[model samples]
Target chain A: SQQGEEDPQALSIQEGENATMNCSYKTSINNLQWYRQNSGRGLVHLILIRSNEREKHSGRLRVTLDTSKKSSSLLITASRAADTASYFCATAGGGGSNYKLTFGKGTLLTVNP
Target chain B: IAGITQAPTSQILAAGRRMTLRCTQDMRHNAMYWYRQDLGLGLRLIHYSNTAGTTGKGEVPDGYSVSRANTDDFPLTLASAVPSQTSVYFCASTAAGPNTGELFFGEGSRLTVL
Candidate 1:
C-alpha cells in the first residue's frame, strides 16, 4: 500500500516562476523526504524534514512538514529548466517497520525555458 | 564514485523466462532495498535487507525474490517473468537505516516482459 500521495499530478510553469507540490501520507512518520528523478534516470535525494521540523531549506528547494495534518509541501523558488523532473515524496515509519520507505505517486514538474 | 551500482541498465525478456537484477553498494550501508516503479502507480518496495543475511518482504514481493548474502551485494530474481512485472527497478541503500538518513540510489534497471 502507498503511504504518501502527491497532489497536482502535473504542473507546468515558466522557468523563473516558483513551483510548489504537496504530499499527504496515511500514517505517522519518522521523517518525510523528497526526491527528484530526471527522465530515464535514477532518483536523487533532494531534502528531508523530520517530524519535529516544520520547515527546511536547501539551495532553491524548500520543504515543509506538518505532522499534525499528515501533509508536506515542497517549494522550488526560481525554477529552472534543469529543475524539470518528477518529484516524489517518501515516508519512513508507521506502517510496521521504520526500515521501509514508502513513496507516493510523484508530481511531474515541467519548467518551460 | 561511492554509490550503488546496478547491472544491465535495461533488458527485455520473454514471458516465463528467468531474470535477475544485480545491485551492489560501495558505501557499506547496512540497509538495502529493491523498489519497482510503474507509471501512475508510483514506487512500490519489492524487498529489503536491514543487514547482511537478513531479508524482508515489502509491499509488493509476490513475483520477486531477493537475496542478501553479503554487505555489498543484493540480487533480485524472477523465477518466471510476466507482463505485469515490466517496470523500472531501482536499488537503494542507507548508511544508518532509512528512517535516520538519506538513501543512495542506483540508476535503475528497466525490464520488459513480453
Candidate 2:
C-alpha cells in the first residue's frame, strides 16, 4: 500500500531549468522526507519537512509540506545534468517513533544537458 | 563511513528455496527496517525493529520474516521463495527520536526467485 503518490511520474528538463515534483498522501503525517537515488545506487537523504514546517531547504533542494492538504512538493532550482535521478517522497505518520516510513512509487527526473 | 551494510549484493534462487538477506548498520541506530522495491510498487516495508531484541511487521509482512538480535543487525528471511518475491531489497536505519526522520539506506540486494 503506497501512502504517498508522486505526480508527473516522470519529468524531463534541460539543464539550468527548475524541476518541481508533487506528492500527495492519504493520511496525516508527522513528517515528509525526500530522497534521491542515482542509477544503480543507494538512496541519499535530501530534505525533510515536518508537519509543522511549511518548507525547508538543503543546498539547492527545497521541500514544502502542507498538512492540511496532505500534499508536499519538492523543487530543484537551477538543475544540472548531475541532478538527474529518481526522487522519492516518504511519509511518516503518527506511530512507532517515526521510524517507519511509507514511500511512493517515485518520480524519475531527467536533466538533459 | 559505512553507515549501513547489506550482504549478498545480488542473488538468484529457485522457487521454494529459503533465502535470507543480511543487513548491518555501523551507526548504532536504534531503528532498522527492511523494504522491498518492485516495478511501480515503490518501497514497501516488510519489517522493522525499534531496538535490539524486538521486531514488528509492516504493511507487507507476508512471505517475509525479520529479526534484530542486536542493535546493529537486522536480517530478513524468506521461508519459501516465490517468483513474486523477486525484487530489490533495501535495508535502512535511523536514530530513534523526535524530528529525526532521515533514513540511511544500504546499496540494496537484488534477489531473483525463479
Candidate 3:
C-alpha cells in the first residue's frame, strides 16, 4: 500500500513562477523527504524535513511538514525550465531497527520557457 | 562515478524465463533497496537490506527475490518472469543509518515480459 499520495497529478507554469506540490500520508512518520526525477533518469534528493521541524529551505527549494495533518508540501521558487521534472514525496515510518520509507505517486511539474 | 550502478539498462524477456537485475553501489553504503515503478502505482519497494548479510521484504515482494551478499551488491531475481512484472526497476542506497532516509538511486532498468 502507498503511504503517501501527492496532489495535482500535473502542473504547468511559465518560467519565473513558483511551483508548489503537496503530499499526504496515512501513518505517522519520523521524517518527510522530497525528490526530483528527470525523464529517463534517476531520482535526486531535494530536501528533507523531520517531524519536529515545520519548515526547511535549501537554495530555491522550501519544504514544510505538518505532522498534525500527516501532510507535507514542497515549494520551488522562481521556477525555470530546468525545474521541469517529476517531484515525489516520501515518508519515513517505523522506529528503532525497523525504519522504512514509503513514496507517493508523484506530481509532474512542467516549467515552460 | 561514486553512486549506485545497475546493469542491463533495459531488457525484454519471454514469460517463464528467469531474469536477474544487478545493483551495485560504490559508496560503500550499508543499506540498499530495490523498487519497481508502474504507470499509476508509483514506486513500490520490492526488497531492502539494512546491512550486508541481512535482507527484508517490502510492500510488494511477490514474484521477486533479493540477496545481499556484501555491502556493495544487492541483486533482485525473478524466478519466472510474467507479463505483469513488466516495469522499470530502480536500485537505491543510503548511508550506515537511515535516520534521514535520503536515498541515492541508479538510472533504472526497464524490463518487459512478453
The global C-alpha lDDT for each of the candidates, from Candidate 1 onward, is 0.93, 0.91, 0.91
Ranking by lDDT: 1, 2, 3
Candidate 2 ranges with C-alpha deviation above 4 Å? A96-98
lDDT for residue A34 in candidate 2, whole number 0-100: 93
Q: How well is candidate 2 docked (DockQ)?
A: 0.65
Please list the residue runs of candidate 3 whose C-alpha ends up more than 4 Å from where it truly belongs after superposition. Answer: B96-98
| Positional deviation of residue B48's Cα in model 3 after best superposition, in angstroms | 0.5
RMSD of each: 1.5, 1.1, 1.0
lDDT of 1 by residue, A1-113 (tens): 89999999999999999999999998889999999999999999999888899999999999999898999999999999999999999998843234778999999999999
lDDT winner, 1 or 3: 1
Proportion of native contacts in model 2?
0.61
Task: Using DockQ, give the best candidate's number.
Answer: 3
TM-score for candidate 1, please give it: 0.97
Deviation of model 2 at B102, angstroms:
0.6
Using DockQ as the yardstick, the better of models 1 and 3 is 3
lDDT of 3 by residue, A46-104 (tens): 99888999999999999998888988999999999999999999988865456667899
Worst 10 residues of 1 chain B by lDDT: B95-104
For every model in order, what is the number of clashing pairs? 0, 0, 0
Candidate achieving the largest lDDT = 1
**Span of ten consecutive residues with least summed lDDT in model 3 chain A:** A92-101
Evaluate model 3: give its TM-score: 0.98
As for lDDT, the candidate ahead, 1 or 2, is 1
